[model samples]
Target: MSHKPTTVAELGEFTVLIDVRSPAEFALDHIPGAINCPVLDDEERRVVGTTYVQVSAFEARKIGGAMVARNIARHLDEQFRDKPRDWRPLVYCWRGGMRSGSFVNWLRLVGWDAQQLKGGYKAWRAHVIEQIAQRAPALDLRVLCGPTGSAKTRVLQALAAQGEQVLDLEDLAAHRGSVLGAVPGRPQPSQKAFETQLAHRLAALDPARRVWVEAESRRIGRITVPEPLLQRLRESPVVEIAAPPDARLAYLLRDYAWLGDDRPALADKLDGLRELLPRDVLAQWREWALAGALAPLFEALMARHYDPLYARSQGRHLAGLPNAHRVASDDLSDAGIQSLAGHIASLP
Candidate 1:
C-alpha cells in the first residue's frame, strides 16, 4: 500500500501558505513564502473571538465555524480559482489548530493536493531559529557598511542584476535603516517578522559564495538584527563608501523623492532631533524646516549627528574588525561598485 506524504519535513521543498489572518499578525511573525490567506479577516476574527469569550462555546463555534467555512470557500473560488490542478499548497493557521485543520480537510475533500503544516507557523518559526542560529555562521560573509544615502541598496541591486551573490537585509526587512528609512506607500514588517524573512532568504543562498549585505545598526526601526547574524556582522570586514557633500545630498533627494508633498513626515522625523540638539541648535533646525531649507537641514543633521555617530560606532567596531578596501562613489562609475565588489570578493 502507498502512503501519502503527511509531515512537513517529508514534503521537502514545497510552496508554503499561511492561512488568512491580519497583516499585523503576519507582520508580527509568519512562515516564509506563507502568503496570508486568512480564514477570517481582522473584523471577522475579532467578532468570532469576542463571541468565543462572551457567548457560549456552542454559539461561538456555530458562528465562527460557519464564518471560517465561508472564508475558505471564498479563498478557493477566488484566490485558488486559477491555480493549476497539480499545484501543491500547504496551509496552516496559527498553531495547526482547528481553524487550519478545517481548511485542510476541506481542501482534501475538494481534490486539491493540500496539507496542513504539522505544528503550523510555530513549527516553521522554530525551524527558522535553528537554521539561522546554528547554520548561518558556517557561511562566508561580505558586509557592505556605509552611512545613510550611500547607495548601498542600489549597489546590491546592481550586483544581483549582474549575477553576483547578494542578500538584501533592507529588502527582506522592508526598511531603509534610518529614522526616515520607511518606504513610502509600503509598510514594513515587525522586527520578529523581519528576522524570520531574513533567515529564510539567507537559507536559500549559496553559503560557500560570499553573501553581500549592507551594514546596519542593531536596530532598523522596530526590528533588531538577529543575534547570530549580528555577531557575524560584528566580525565581518567593512566596505566604506565615500561621497562628496553635494553627491550625498543629491543621493538623499533622489532616494526620498517619494516623500514628494509629505512635508509633515519630514518634519516629524527631523523633529525627533530636538532632544539631541542644544536649545539654539534646535531653534536653528526648526527655522530650516520652517523656511523649507531642506538641503541645509539635511546637511547639518548628517554632519552633527549621523556622521559623528557613525564615526564613533565604526571606530569602536574597527578596533576588533579588520578594514576591507574603501570605494569612493565619485571615483567609481556605474560599474565601479562591481569592480569594488570583485576586489572584496578576492580578499582572504
Candidate 2:
C-alpha cells in the first residue's frame, strides 16, 4: 500500500525519507534528514523539460520514464541492496508527481512499504514558511544587541550552556552577518535551506520560555531572515552588552585569527568596502592585512566603520533600544561571557 502524506507531520512515521527531485533541486532544500536519490540527473531533467516544450509530451514522458527506471535500478543495486523487505521509506519530488510516484511504485513492488508525500517538496516548504509565520509571533524573544566584536555569539553559546533556549542565527545561516563574516572553509546554505533550518529550530522551542537571539539585520550573507521572525526580533526587548574598545579589539583578534592566515582573501573582502570607504583607506587596510598588523587594522575598522554603522542601524531598526537592559563588561573571556549570560538570564 502506498501512503500519501499530506503534511510534513505525517512524514515523521517513515524510517527513511528520500527526495527524488533532481540533485540541483535537492541541493536547494528538502526535509532536514531526507536523503537525495535523484530520479533524474540535472542534465536529464533539463533535456526532458526541453523535449516536453519543444517536441511532444508523450516523447518527453517516454524518455524521462526510461531515465528514471535506469536510475531507480542503480539505486536498488547500490543504495538499497542491503535493505530488509520490511523497510519503510517516504519519497517526495517537486510536486509529488510522476518522479516520486514512479519511485514509490517501484519500491512497493520490491516488497517494501513506500509512501509518497501528497504535495511533495512544495508542500513541505509551504509548511515551513507557515510555521515561521505562525510561531514567530508567539515566541518570547530576547534580542542580544552589541556592536561588532562584542562577542555576542560567544555570549549566546554561554547562555545555551546554561540550558537557555537560544536561537544562534549565525550558526544556522553559516554566516557572521557581515561582509567579512564568512566562516573559513564553510559555505553558506541555500536560502531555502536556511529557512528550513530556521523553521525547525523555531519549532522546537517553548513559547512560554524566553528565547535569546543575536540582533541581526534582515540580510545574513545571501540568506534573509524571514520577515515575521525579523519583525519579532526588532520588536523584542534587547539586552545590550557593552565592552571597551581594547577588549573588543582583543576579541576580534583572537576570534578572527583565521583571516590573518589568508591575507589575499582578507584583502579581497576589504576591497568590497571600496564604495563605502575611501580608496586610500582601503589600500591602507589591505597593507595592514598583508603585513599581519591585524590589531591596528581591527581597531581602525571598529572605530571608523563597524561601530558607526552598528549605531546608526541599531537606532533605526531596534526602535525598542531605549528601554534595552544594558550590561557592561571589561573582558570578553569565557568567564566574562558566562557572567553576561547569567545577567541576561536574570533579566525581568
Q: Estimate each model's TM-score.
A: 0.83, 0.96
Q: Each candidate: RMSD to true structure?
A: 3.4, 1.4
Candidate 1 lands at a TM-score of: 0.83
Please provide, for model 2 over 126-222, each residue's C-alpha lDDT reduced to its tens digit, 9 standing for 90 to 100. 9999999999999999999999999999999999999999999999999999878998878999999998999999889999999999999999988
Error of 2 at 322 (Å): 0.3
Worst 10 residues of 2 by lDDT: 1-10
In candidate 2, which residue pairs clash? none
What is the C-alpha lDDT profile of model 1 across 23-83, one tens digit per residue?
Answer: 5677678765568877877888788789888987888889888988888898889877787
- List ranges where model 1 is wrong by over 4 Å: 1-5, 10-29, 35-37, 75-88, 111-113, 244-247, 257-260, 318-322, 332-348
State the lDDT at 312 in candidate 2. 95
Model 1: number of clashes? 4
